[model samples]
Target: MISMFVTDLDGTLLKNNRYITKEDKEALQLLNKKGVDITIATGRSDREVQAVFKELNITGHRISQNGTFTFSKYNENVFSQVFEEGTSLKLFDFLHAFDFPCLISNFDNIHYAKEIPMAQTLQSLFKTPLIYQQDLRNRIEQDFSTSKFMLLGETSELLSLEKKIISLFDTDVSTFLSADMCLDIVPKGADKRRALEALLNQTGIKKQATASIGDGFNDINMLAYTPHSYVMSSAEPKVKLHGKKTVQHVYEAVDDLFCHNLIL
Candidate 1:
């Protein structure tokens, strides 16, 4: 019996407008009332998850920062991972070479270079304030460490950048395309699947009892880890292939899953 529902936020749970529909909310509420654990696993930050919960009026654990951090709705930190300072510095140099706008994110805060135009764009998308610093390398070296770094730009450019970073960093870094225009870099093996595994261990939930839903490439790993997994109908072809089922919308998927007794 599936007793846990782990969903991604952007395109799986949130509509195109980035808000949870009434149907989606009701479905989650119903699952919650049934004692099913409903959680969000996304490439977003803890702050972003909190904002999403507030807007949707949903309470559950969260896997954030592309699985580098896991915490509950009450802001308790359950598990976290950080990138090494030297490795992060090397990565910063590589990203600087590409001239792509980037965000240096830790489990606690998101820091940005002063000159990155895309920083404001991402801030607007996340509806969160940006923490700007002049010397990004020094800032990363001194004040913060990261579980992940997120880059925003066109797909082609980001992909090329990713290849270059991989060649340079080798096995020490793991790279993935979270969105068409978003590239995420983390320590090797730090991903949503690992995050979910950690969450399951901490909560004493069986892997087969969890259902994961997502709509983007970064979500693929988590989707594959759960027994019952769903991909949004609108997801890219590659992402859709990873899920056992696909739905046109979040509520429809949840409704079908429950009504058909697909999950216990």
Candidate 2:
């Protein structure tokens, strides 16, 4: 029987990368009524999760920036980590050579350092406001630590960048494709599983009592970490095998878990 459930946003929870469905709302309400703790683990920022919580009228734990940060249900930050200034600058320099829309993100906001004509579109796509910090290096100079670095571009470019990142910064950072065209880079050893472990230790939820669902490469570790896991049906073929089962909606996963627990 699972006492805690963790899910990723975007493609998983947010149907079609947009809004939550009525069924998802019902599932969340049902989980709450059943006294099951909920956690949203995603590559998105905390504010985005809070926005979803606002829409659902629900709150749980949040593991954001691909698990670089973890926050409790009470809104207290239990654990957090970010790229050091030197490393961030080195990455920033490497990223600047590419014309792909680059972003520097923190726990608070997503930022753009170069001219991006499609800024408005990206803002809408990211579901968050994009702040322009003409010089990201300067921001880092102000005691700033970046939560993640992002690049949105063609698949070819992203593929090349992924290889470059792996070859150049293999031990310095972790990079993965969060979406079809979006590649995200975070501090080394940071991932959903590591962050979830921090949350579990604080909340006293054992791995056996936890279930998670996700549909992205960044979610692979998380799906593997939790004993009971689900993969979204719409996810890439390679990602589906990580979960014990596949579901198209959050409610279905909840229902399956409830049945396993003999609660239904």
Candidate 3:
């Protein structure tokens, strides 16, 4: 009865190298043949997500920026949630207290506080322009309107910063740890679940017909909301606990869920 397959990109769908495995590709093809809608929900930007789709030959609606934006593979915008101008400025001021690097994602570009090692690493991985700026506040105000903000640093530092930001903002913004060293911020209540709801509303798909797969903490809300939820076997314990079932990998689940029945 599952009509939609919602997957997280990093560590869930894509391998560590950021490429879809042949097994995953075959699984998706099988799902398509069975009339299932395969979609993606991730913390990446539209540009990054599009690149992934092109590499995988996937055509589906994508929920990006941890649900701040939703668009289709055909480059159509379906939904978006942007931070208020004042909120953006407040966050920028607060982040200035920390020395760790950060990136601000607008509709089309990524702006950095300063050139950092992590920025360079991500540039090599994503192949997107990384604009270095001395004054992020001015740069954000002038060049682009931010949809989401991300911070990269050690886990302890990021956690400490997350606590402080939440205490100060007091629910003014939503915060999530996508990885051990990564913190993603969006407007309060703007999460993957909210984005899933919006997508369901737009496509007239019921909750019972949806399935979500993920491998991280940021994906918990969306997994909880879906009726048929799955977590990767390689996911952290907390993430694994949220799903009704766990699979060894994206392809294993896809193969079992869609292909095994074909020969019978």
Query: Which model scores highest in TM-score?
Result: 2
Report the number of the highest-lDDT candidate: 2
lDDT of 2 by residue, 1-264 (tens): 677889999898987677899998889878977888889998889989888888888778999989888999998888898998888888999999888898888889899889899887777766788899886788886777888998989977898889988898888899878888889999999999999999999999889999999999889988988889999988888888788999998889999988876333
lDDT of 3 by residue, 1-264 (tens): 677888998888877736787888878766766777778898888777777767667677889889989875455677888887888889988886688777888878778876687666778655468778778788667656788888988988898889889999866789988866789988888888988898888788899888889988899999999977889888889888889889867776665555534212
Model 2 lDDT, residue 14, Cα: 86
When summed lDDT is taken over every stretch of 10 residues in candidate 3, the lowest stretch is 255-264
TM-score of 3: 0.92
For model 1, the local distance difference test gives 0.80
lDDT of 1 by residue, 1-264 (tens): 767888888777767636788888888888887888888888888888888877767688988888788886565778788888888888887777666777888766777774775555566667467788778688777857767888878899888878878888877888888766889998888888998888888888999888888888888888888878888888889888899998877777677677778666
Clashes in model 3: which pairs? Answer: none
Clashes of each: 0, 0, 0
Q: After TM-score superposition, what is the CA distance of residue 159 in candidate 1 from its true location, in Å?
A: 1.0
TM-scores for candidates 1 onward, in order: 0.93, 0.96, 0.92
Given candidate 3, what's the lDDT at residue 191? Answer: 86
Tell me the deviation in Å of residue 2 in model 1.
2.2
| Higher-scoring candidate on TM-score, 1 or 3 | 1
**Per-residue lDDT value at 195 in model 2:** 93
- Number of backbone clashes in candidate 3: 0
Q: After superposition, how far is residue 101 of candidate 1 from its true place, in Å?
A: 0.7
**Which 10-residue span in candidate 2 carries the lowest summed lDDT?**
255-264
Taking every candidate in turn, the Cα RMSD to the unseen true structure, in Å, is 1.8, 1.3, 2.3
